[model samples]
Target: MINDQLMLLERAFLNSRAFPEKRYYSHVLWAPRTGSVATFPGLSNACSSATNTASGSAAWAEVQRQLSILVAALEGAAATLRPVAEL
Candidate 1:
């Protein structure tokens, strides 16, 4: 189950990085007058605004943190699963 969850998180993280729109949880507007502007200015400032903040971005940051932890654990598990000849 843990492996399956890790795979799901890994796939999600890869997809987010692979796709242009998925890179940021907030909407990106391309305006000639304003140039390129982010609707929420990414997750770096998720806690800046109390009432007008983007909740999805904050949740995405937590998910990213969990994914990183899962990846490290999976790497350790993979090392243990390596063949004796390779160890």
Candidate 2:
């Protein structure tokens, strides 16, 4: 179960970071958004609002929705399997 939780957290984090082109877990890492934004230098502030803004991004919205669905599905599957596992 601990291994499963760790794997789920790993997957959730990777999905949250928006890196899905990976074919192998041993070869890919998630890039930090903070580091990406750190190089902006606070000049002009005219970067693409989707990647820069908090409330108007389609990527952010999809991440939220996908995570919610993932949580729901995982909980449902675990609930269904719990009683059977106990027996």
The candidate maximizing TM-score is 2
lDDT of 2 at 72: 53
List, residue by residue over 1-87, the lDDT tens digit for candidate 1.
455545554333222321133454312111112113242132222223323546567555644553454455456556544445432
Task: In angstroms, give how far residue 32 of model 2 lies from its true place.
Answer: 24
Taken over the whole model, the C-alpha lDDT of each candidate is 0.38, 0.39
Model 2 lDDT at residue 86: 27
RMSD of each: 11.2, 8.8
TM-score of model number 2: 0.33
Clashing pairs in model 2, backbone N/Cα/C closer than 3 A: none
TM-score of 1: 0.33
Provide the lDDT at 25 for model 1.
31
What total of clashing residue pairs does each candidate reach?
A: 0, 0
